[model samples]
Target chain A: MSDSDGRRGATRRGFIKGALAAGAGAASAGAAGAEAGDPAITELQPWMRAFGPGVDASPYGLPSEHESHVRRRYVEWLRPDTISAVNFTPIHQLDGIITPNGLCFERHHSGVALIDPGRHRLMINGLVDTPLVFTMEDLKRFPRENRIYFLECAANSGMEWRGPQLNGCQFTHGMIHNLMYTGIPLRHVLDEAGLKPGAKWLLAESADAAAMTRSIPLEKALDDCLLAFAMNGEALRPEQGYPLRLVVPGWEGNMWIKWLRRIEVGDRPWHQREETSKYTDLLGDGRTRRFTFEMDAKSVITSPSPQAPITHGPGPTIITGIAWSGRGTIARVDVTLDGGVNWHTARLSGPSFDKSLHRFYFEFDWDGRPMLLQSRAIDSTGYVQPTKDALRAVRGVSSGYHNNGIQTWAIDSEGRAENVEIS
Target chain B: MSRFRDLAALSLGVILAASAAFAQQGGKLGLGRPASPDELAAWDIDVRPDGLGLPEGRGDVLTGEELYTGLCAACHGDFGEGTGRLPALAGGEGTLTDEFPVKTVGSFWPYLSTVWDYVHRTMPYGNSQSLSDDEVYALTAYILYLNDLVDEDFVLTRENLPAIRLPNEGGFIPDDRAGTELPAFSAEPCMENCKDRVEITARAGALDVTPEAEER
Candidate 1:
């Protein structure tokens, strides 16, 4: 055998040897059936001894039972009813760039609408050469594009504006999900209808009970907007607007209307309730800032967080998290172990797609010391994620939306982590 | 007579050829059909701040109060103070600058049309779009009354609804993040000793909002 092959074989044998030694130790400590040094090589595990379930067992597969703990969770007190509620993704348990389809966070104004794809129709009218209606099949006929983007609710960390109100990263930072979306560019559909000369804004209307609507600028609609029909390479989940949804890239999640039905081109912004009353950012001076579309660059350490506290005593540890920006791609992520005293640039890994979640890591050997962990991200636009105090200095604590402040996790000597604000 | 007949036949042939070309081009993609006017109208329920799509309707405060109590009181509370986690629609008039601002329709909303449009589109929570135009108008008036914006005897019509200025009409300014924030935040962030001393100001765990960690 080649020298490389021999090295590989030795590594595999070493792993097996270590596992067997651990198994033998457990067996000897248990019932008096096995010898300590003499390992049972002839014995087989339960799966190896018996026939496994057939492929037909699960027509639709689910994650292993062991992974049941990883799920979208919501604080019951946040809303009156689940219908008009928000559920957070378990960011602490999740790894990598893409959030699993099942665990993508959900924020619905009206409960999920499970409309039949056959009955769904998308209408493009108002200030167009021809008002057109497209069925689900008709929408499929158009040329499509795939993009990976992060959808963050403007209020993702709103509760943290006043102070660090949620301990776990799952609750504080889980209101966002990164997904690979497959859909047609919204520009093509608008072009098909032939926008009139005076058209400046497009009103995207949803088919849900609330009929959620938002007036998007015509420039944005023609730029990077998408009419998504599938997510993560599968038909969208019913709760995620199965028939169709709008993907307003780099914008607030609320503007990405689900169960989208109509697009009405107009000459000016509609100044609807969402843009004016709800999503507007209220300043310290009591004046509200309207149409704050782009989500600022933000980063949060997912591991070593409240949910995924350090269990393996000390020594070599990988401090990893996700960093993203709505304005553009993440330029760099700097992690601070001693709060703002010192900072180290984290290594960016995986596909660094624009306006998408970029996984970052910092390998450190913990010397069994308490740590004040924090992450700060700078986007391609050179907009750095500000400190909590810096953000409060400008927008103040009264504001609920667009609280993209640097999050800090205080790791105690025992390795338990908690959310905290530093001054 | 023969020449005239020949000319007529030639014109008919040209018309037929042009129509055939049109048909070929029209059916090339074979995608969606042109939506009928009626079909488009059914789904177009958007109401702009300019009262562009507000249906012809009228409702007074008395009618609004009765409808609000029956349809919206359970969640919004009779006084629009909001029940439980539901949104408070009234009160909080001068609390915008307060530490805990109570942003209700009366105090925070910039446009009266938004109040009318949202209630018409999504109010009564579960049973949306069940309210008639008149009922929505009444609800809007009642909510305005609750906020103490308008007198009880005032009637809300499409013509005057847009004219009624909200209390915080001038409170909104277009986004200035690009100018005010981006420039200042764009500075090369510091690497070493950003601050002399760091102090723990607050702790979220102390509030007990997060659930207890599950046993491994």
Candidate 2:
């Protein structure tokens, strides 16, 4: 709808009531409910259907043919070619905390290299007392652990700092995905090298065509970091570090080098180009900040924000979205109904894990008036998601990375939500 | 003087008693048992900052260049400039200012240890660790040579590899935010009347709706 239409003689309240009365239960959910009532007609298919012949159809396994709209979206301007610097995930269309594997966004410095798992080898060298190379089978012999964490690119939701450039959440917040990872603890492998007294850091390297590498602190390595092999209970997809990747807990996703091949122990930290020139934040001054690794706590109201709009009337409205923290588990999330005025605590739902997305819901009885919506997250460490103005006040828009601005959704009297900038 | 000595001895006894109680609690949880030698041997594969885990191997730049040309040149480029869709593995020194800053091995990596560890562990496009130990050393030597970090005749053996020093060796320090910054801001935050009022400034397109207008 045009901006000028709501300003006409008939207010948005009258217009919404008329539309709802004319099209009772014709929305997306209502249509789905109307189509599938009978649940028990498929038992005869296995014996009757001819598999070798032309008579067969898929039953339990499928990506809905109609879900073509849910495919990955690429930012054409980001990279010169499609293989590298691809766009991130579309969190707007996704409904729960977990991002389905098919729709998980991808970014590859070099095009995805298909690796034969049987032939893959991970080598540990450098300052280690005894360098060792472990085959995939050897890696599996070690004890395994599982943990769910969110991997967010430093550039997630970066474009919004200048303006509300993207209309969908997939484009804005899609550069992040959460999954349960299965792998061996980094400490187990580090222990094998017999770290010397002065050793303080290690470098993880990828065997991709780009040969990506990053320096990790010794403390973090000995902590919860993992030498991940599987994601979300299955072998990682080709786009996501297929054979092996470094699972650096609570850190940036790019640092989790996919197709990992080597680790070198060292007496000091490595200031590789990835850390100093690219990942480092260049502030307002000429001086550049380095090794700024931790991704801060952030949240956004997915529904009632952009991609999903409110078409119902002023009665019981279900407002929902996602919240997460890199430092630790989320403690609380607040939903602002009237802009930033009196705030109401939203109910946080789903399994809460450290560095994992927390789903939240806020139900309100609307009275057919224009409303502004926003969400704020508080992590276990007591760090609050900063307001857009607050972030701009300190860092300014020039720094495009690590933007956790408080997103605002303005709902008109007509029940439509628009991306809005709160001064 | 006797009374003072008695009080001091009594205080010391109380402190020791408290410590014993703490130790007993820790013992119940089985927290401080040193891992068995076998247990340590089973899982300890980590390489430290020093040259600890390096295996016996050696290679020269001449052999490394051949390996690179065969396995990596397709994607990384003959000169390590990186291809159209792949990341450039060379150049990018002091160019963090350019609109499209290219960070490569020569320009940005802070630790020589990382370069060695990364290359040895994972490298080449399709085949991972398919190369022998000598091949990894050769590849490392060739890459260092390409970046002008080392001479063309440089040989990367278990002996000389640790001697190479990276440019940004002192670039990183322990995170100072918790100790140096957070404490200063930990005082009671102003909760009420700190900000008089907030005003609305912008909105997203999909969020705003108008029923009077025909659907697009």
Candidate 3:
């Protein structure tokens, strides 16, 4: 329905009555016989009459018990073992663009490495004027920068490459997190050591047992890379590389090595296992695409999704979600209520950081009809998010990464939603 | 207080202060000490596509098969078929275009350095960085044999590794989405009446692939 539909003739009392009449079993429990305001306001409540615990109850505060459900969840089949496993951040349960450090999605190759800051070291060797090793204290002595960027694993939405399969937005797109990284510009450190004349490539290596590695072009390393030591105003979590991590802005997450220990300057790219056998994108004609970095602009409706179904019987509702791009900031987002039949411009809000998540919302009064909802994002580079069919047309369904297609969620008459693809 | 003891202490303090000043004057910001040659060797295991870092090593196919049976057969399979959800090292030669593309090392990897480096750096599952250089060369040769790329009696060495090439050496190209996909996808999208009608094509609930929510 249009924005003016409900404001024309409906009164506040009338709207509430209409919603309750259509709400069915969704009404509050014992609503059939409860006296108005008796148990809550008219009577004394337990919390008002009791004393609560003081500040020292917790040395470090945690989320309230009621919010225990809001957490990182993993698909059992996706991670055969805890090692070489991943878990999705509960994006649907959050608001705003900054994902809390504790709730960020984690991808580990060899499980979490617990390192003592005093014992940890970062080494830079190969083709340099001087090879150097910095203790964690020495690293902190350098100038630092704070910038927010989204690190998305290439395999995000990989399960949906063939079709809509995952039930919620979290499972399909949870292999991503946006946060502020505090670190020294890799160029500063590289300049201090001094690159040799023939240096053209960099090999980022991790300290985990997997010893994960990826090759990066020297131009990219100097342009916007970071030897990040902190994230979101605190020391990096052990699960998130602890003392140090590499921040490759707008690149695939695998290249942003965690538990980062060494960087080798060279004249050529090192064909590591992560790059050649895994992250490469396979096409329909037996050919592959390597280094398919830079996540395209994409958006998804977090609310009114399968997990967070609308519950107010559709008088006035808020539809909100997230949009981001690796190439640039999100320029605009257009949401559709009737699938692809029409679109409405969504309002972008909160701080808009480049290469970071942007929150958006579309408020409308629902007329209580079944709907097919979808959102499309256009980035600063003028690249419009394509349909799943559009992406499949050129790349074919063989690819398991870079599936940044528009997503559709079908909402039924009873105010329930399901993951679906529209024809 | 002894005058001789005080004089000795003052002279020691002066020397300590001088060395502290000298250590802080290296490189920019005077941070991080020079890495020793031995220190670089401890962590420098990267191998380039052109065989830049291939260490001296030699191993025959028979030796590789025996080592493979002892160390890698549990997860990677005896013939590199891959047991459970672990990755396969061979076969799936022409299925890259099929609906279910079976990406194996032989059929998919573009460089021999990747196979050799992976075995050397992070193989043996839980016990990574434990294999010797010769053992890594043997395991790589065994994988080549599994992929039918090397003869059963072939011996792989550091010198010969550069000449060896995988089947899909030329199968990969750099990302071209900017050139191939950006233009078509950048047009001003339709705002109204774009579709006459919409119908549900597939549903996630119908497939039941979603893991049970309550399961930890």
Could you report the DockQ of all the candidates, in the order they appear?
0.36, 0.11, 0.40
Q: What docking grade applies to model 2?
A: incorrect
Candidate 2 wrong stretches, greater than 4 Å: A1-60, B1-176, B179-197, B202-216
**True-structure lDDT of candidate 3:** 0.86
- Candidate 2 chain A minimal-lDDT segment of 10 residues: A38-47
| Per-candidate iRMSD | 9.2, 10.4, 8.9
Clashing pairs in 1: none
- Steric collisions counted per model: 0, 55, 0
Q: Tens-digit lDDT track for model 1 on B34-152?
A: 99978976887777778888889999999999998898898888799998888899999899999999988889888888888888788788787788999988889988999888899
What is the TM-score of each predicted model, taking all chains together? 0.89, 0.67, 0.91
Candidate 2, after superposition: displacement of residue A180 in Å?
Answer: 0.8
Number of the predicted model whose DockQ against the real structure is largest = 3
After superposition, candidate 3 runs with Cα above 4 Å error: A1-35, B1-27, B214-216
Off by over 4 Å in 1: A1-44, B1-30, B214-216
- Candidate ordering by DockQ (highest first): 3, 1, 2
Compared with the true structure, what per-residue lDDT tens digits does model 2 show for residues A42-127?
Answer: 24556366654243466435575445445667866556776557765657667778887777789887788799998787877666
* Candidate 2 lDDT by residue in tens digits, B1-216: 999888777776786676466444422211112344454333333332455556678889999999889888988899999987576778776664454456666765555545555565445544544577788888878888888888888888877777776554443344444563334423433333334566666544544332222121
